[model samples]
Structure formats: structure tokens, C-alpha cells
Target: MGWFGRKRDPQDANEMLRQYNEAEAARLAGLSSGSNLAPTTVSASFSSAEFAVEDVFTITGRGQVVTGTVASGVIRVGDRIVVLRDGADVGSSEITGIEMFRKKATEAAAGTLAGLLLRGRVDVARGDVIRTSASA
Candidate 1:
């Protein structure tokens, strides 16, 4: 009959959850409008500026696998050739080696040249997206 004596019904729990989610969404939306989120956008990444498909771009600085859900990883300088089947998930593609520089010339399209590990295939077109695996 008192405060401790009342059991929370499912409807009350659902309402509480809904309110929490709405509040959280509002907070995140506000935060994203600030500067910190700006630097992480794709347009802010080196990939957008430094890479060009069919034109083999290079980065002098080092890179880490900061974020990924890769099946395998490799870095080939030239035609060292670590082939991946089209549409293969990040976890299934095998990266046979690492190539810091292409001793010979290699080519890639701006959108097709993926990350350092070749995390995804050179298959993402101008506007396609491959998300990091949820479990990764």
C-alpha cells in the first residue's frame, strides 16, 4: 500500500524506457551539432582527400586500425595481389601481406580504394557504405 509496496507494471517500465530513449536521443543530437563530431565525418577523413582510384595515392604518416570488423587485412604496395571476392564480408577476406609503399605503380578509384588493411573491398562506390561489424 506504500511506496516500497508498489510493484512496477510493464506499462510503467515501457513508458520509462521510452522517455529515457527520447531524452538520450535529444542529448546526442545536441552533442553532434558541436565540433567534436565534425572531425570524424567521412568528409574530414584523409581517405576523402588523399585517395584517388586509378591514381594510387600515398600517405606519409602512419595509420592504425582504429576501427574495423575485418575478416583479414593486408597492405600491398603494387600488384602484390591480395585478392578478395566481391561482396565478401570484412571478416572473410584474406589479406596475404602488408605493403607500406608501392615499389611499382598501382591504381584505385577514389571510392574503391579502401583503408590501410583493405578492411573492405575496393568495391564501395561513390556513395556506398560498409559499416564496421556490430560485434567488432
Candidate 2:
């Protein structure tokens, strides 16, 4: 974002990017105050690093499981949660917590490839796209 270099603060710049594109927030995603989202496609990954909070990164995941399964701790792309169990079609009674990477996710579009999950869950199968509930 050299063009937006003057935006100042990576978080602010990210917010500016969100204001520009203006993607819809997940109705059930439970966003925080003063949170804005912008949906755009780009490659992202995450890793452990010794840096300040300003240092940001991305993570991606893919899957083909039932939509309902995602809510049942399926660990989709851009989620920040821990993997307590590693099994397919696991029962909700066994799984615990909504695993995710970031508190506020931006641009969750359901498509062949998903971009942005901090930890990047390995279980997510291929060809699963988390899309916005909007018309193109």
C-alpha cells in the first residue's frame, strides 16, 4: 500500500482499506466495536515472530465439509482457535470453542481458495470458499 503510505498505522490503513471496499460483517461472527471489514482476494499466512503488534500477517485454509460443520469447530480459513481434536465429522459434544486466528475477520468469501487465517487450520479440505452474503 505504498500509494496509501500516508494512511499511518497499519491497523488504521487496514481500516481504511475496509472503509473503501466495505464488506458486510458476519451476522453471527460477533465483531468488536469500531470494527470495519473489506473483502478482497489475496494470499495470506501466519507464523510465530518476535515483533510488535503492528507486524501483521495472513493465513489461509480450504475444505468441503457441510456448512453446518464449519460452525461446529471445523476451523475455517481466518479462524483463531486451538485444535483439541483431529477427527472428521466429529460430534459437537466432543469439540469445544470456536477456533480462530483473528478476532475480527475481513473478507470471508467462500470460494475454491480462502485467504487469511492466522494459524491456518490443516483440516480444512480443498475447494471451500467462505463468501460474503452479497450479489456480485
Candidate whose TM-score is highest? 1
Q: After superposition, how far is residue 38 of candidate 1 from its true place, in Å?
A: 5.8
- CA lDDT, every prediction? 0.32, 0.27
lDDT of 2 by residue, 31-136 (tens): 4343474222222222210100111232234321222112211233333322212222211111112222334333322221122333222333322222211111
Candidate 1 per-residue C-alpha lDDT over 104-134 given as tens digits, one digit per residue, 9 for 90 to 100 = 2233333222343343344423222233222
Instruction: List candidate 1 stretches off by more than 4 Å.
Output: 1-11, 37-39, 44-129, 132-136
Backbone clashes under 3 angstroms, per model: 9, 20
